[model samples]
Target: MPAVAPTLPDDLREDPRYYLRHFQFVLDWVAAHHDSLLAESEWKFIVGFGELPEVSQALLVRMVSRKGELFRLSRLDYAEIGDSDRALVPLVEAGMVIRDPLIGLDELFAQLRVPELRQCFAERLAAHGIAKSATRQRLLDVIQEYEEAGDAEPQRRRLSHWWTETTDQLVQLTVMPVCDRLRLMFFGNLHQTWSDFVLAELGLVRYQQVDLGELSHAFQCRGDVDLYLALHDLRGRLDEGESIEALLTEIPPPAQDNPWLAERRARLLYRLGQQAQRDGDIPLALHCYGLAGPGEARIRRLRLLERQGEYAEAHRLALEAQASPCGEAEQQGLERLLPRLARKLELPRPELPPTRQPRARVLELPADHLVICGSVELAVRDAISHSDRPAWYVENGLITGLFGLLCWEVVFAPLPGAFFHPFQHGPADLRRDDFVARRRRLFDTALARLDDGSYRDVILDHRQRCAGLANPFVHWELLEPELLSLALDCIPAMDLRCMFQRLLLDPAVNRSGLPDLVQFLPGERPSYRLIEVKAPGDRLQDNQRRWLDWLGRHHISVEVWHVEWRHD
Candidate 1:
């Protein structure tokens, strides 16, 4: 059975307390669909929260949506919730908020302004022979030194103890961790916050609605949720400059069942390895890269080995990667690495495959040409454009936009772990390895329109229907009606099919590296040619070179135009 969708109020702006309503909606939705996944404590909190007063709920929601877990009562004044003190009473009684909790010195420094600090620590500052007008950092340092040097216990105190004059209390929301778990379940990631609801309510951002089934949960089991939370914590620690060795030990082993979780784990390991390498911990970097999942990790490990003078191991890994590379980037890296490794070991030099060089031409334009056009690519486009053939500086936008429109349904299909939330720009697994394999039939059906004459109409209808909708591939701002129509008329469906097939092969990598501009030759038999622009001393990147080579093999007209400033 499909899960019942949350019915939002028709006019959110009419209600000043809309955020409270949105929070209630999420709780009800999670309780209905994901009750089995919730812990006993979480279930209790959810049930108890529903029984709280409206103002209390609003206050709690506000805290959860705010930046920090601890908030000063004076700072939390909201006209919508009549009196924060009254709202906080019910929250404190319900054990959802901690009042006057012990806070560290660092947190105290953050909570109080410099004037407040001076007022509170005036006697201590004078006794320590520090000036009253000292900066906040200087004051904190002197106080910390005095506290550490003395026998008094570490300076942990309640807000009242820090500032006795004011009655303002500091309260910490105890349910923030639980709320974060619920949020992760709803959004499948922590990056999206409560602001998404507000943005959607105000019609600032839009999303495609997909019907979610009873089984359409982001996590399959409790272990998946736990692993995800662990990873989230580890990433936070990593960002805070936590010890790499300690974090490495804390990362959970790769999940064998969930590819999504495993991929995240691999990415974390890759990041940790990069940090370790930058820190000059060669052995740790090698250890991390060796254990990481398939991708640049293997190539990174090879590079580290070669650098450490382990030529034999590097050569073996290079050969293994040569047999089946992770992606074009790694393959390109290996092509350069193998010959060097062979020479280092004094072995037979490996003969690398011949690479295709893009067809190049030079144009010496006046220096003012760039100033007038605002960019080298635009200047070159204007230089070569003719009445018969029009050009636009659409690097990767046009082709990707067309592909997105043509395959809208397939991309947004209601698959497990893909469309769990309403605020998603695209499917969660759009860049995953099995993204295409999971919906092979749907993609094939969508692509079949190209073979027939139905592709043009289908794409046009989608462009009309889904205009302004957020999509990962579609650059809606770039897809003007006339440009889209011209593309539909000029670019052959076979060529689109080829480009889309390449995109499906690896969406993460292939989505980029397209030509900087495209020129359309409109006529009875409309045709187009892709152009890549380069300024003086600028050269094509490996990805761009790969695209040019692939386009040439497919008989697509592409050129590399190098621009040089004219001296005369």
Candidate 2:
């Protein structure tokens, strides 16, 4: 039998097709005005989703409606089957959901195992006339009963699928209408329209506030819950009515020494530090940073030091942090700050020889070189990789990979006061002279590491370390050890290392816009050339120019190849 759609309320049951008609109308509007209807990524997502089977598509709709990525299978209320595992198999196969091994009952209750939550649960049970010694058993029995009741509600779904379905163009175009309808229902402003009525009927958009109530304990322990509540309370108090001292009183110390608790405490302190700094309480800001995580806390403290006109101290801290940044954003901030502090303190800048023109002439490509995929660089990479010669599309991949391998110790070293602060804007006060001097140590260290064979193991070891990080500088998979070893073998160690250093040290300017491809000649003294490829109407970016200038000054063999399209 065909699965029955759930019976709708009186308002929508009058005409069942009303919802479908409204959905179609919304899609028509989107099709007519797609440019204004959705962002590029959103449009792409919609188009990709439409190509899936209706069952898979519906699952995604239901998943998004719940406003969470992870869902419990036991709670799922599927119209098609009692067990959703088989239905979800296609979604997993499609790479829309990651099907982890089933979660057991014990892991679900781990949060309640915390002393605070256990006590809270036990106390609640005891209030119901259960004996104090028997509170634990009574609470567990109540939880088991609650679990049985909850199991019938609806199964949940996981959200970690990385959208692998969008790769097909045809599928994406087909899915556009479904995405359009979903977007209209979830996010659009509703009026006295059939669409609005049907949307409410289907429960796609929720106006009601969602809270787990007692079930929240299943996720976070009482201590974390309290901290979360306090953080929100602090935000409101700081914005509205409370004095700094009063606000500080609500911020609690970490109740547990776990990483999660430490992170929570650090975040609270960081926020308090920001508020204190804005309020012109430098000492308080410094104190909060003192207790906060090494990532943003250290950077904020450095800023406070600079603001206090302690140029000497700021410069010292900035130099120390510059060698191993918490992240690219932090490094950029420090690079910008270093020069100003140095100028203020009358520090001598690093000396460099005048920029020199390339000793090897720019290699020009044939006037009829075919452009591929709107990228001359990619075309060059393709040609070089496919050729018999020992070549790869190394680009930034090679140097960074080598650096990660050789300078692992220096790269991952804890920069004193280095902490990651997300969503921080790049520094507004950047000076070229300050960076030229501050980056010397980074460059020199990289050079020294290249001279020693020990650093190769460091890079290999760093592979495991970097996997857990958000953005890794080197992609080890792309540049395999054998290929990288070959490149290093051919190129002079210091020269290769310095080129990589130039890219790593001044990453803000010189990291990207590297030459398109690198090819090594097979000989006694293996020679490698850096090639920049450009198609018609393509020009070098400022950063690329800076890289080329640096490469030339260091006497590295580099060339620019202008590729012209061939009409067959």
Highest TM-score, which number?
A: 1
Off by over 4 Å in 2: 1-374, 381-388, 414-447, 456-471
Query: What is the C-alpha lDDT profile of model 1 across 429-494, one tens digit per residue?
Result: 876778899999999999999998899999999999999888889998899998898899899988
Model 1 worst lDDT run, 10 consecutive residues: 1-10
The lDDT values for all models are 0.88, 0.54
- Model 2: per-residue Cα lDDT over 291-402, one tens digit each: 7756678788888898888888878877888778765446546656776777788877633334554443333444344433345666666656533356677676777666
RMSD in Å for candidate 2, one decimal?
24.0
Alpha-carbon error at 481 in model 2, in Å? 3.4
Model 1 TM-score?
0.94
Please give the range of 10 consecutive residues that has the lowest summed lDDT in model 2: 420-429
Clashing pairs in 1: none
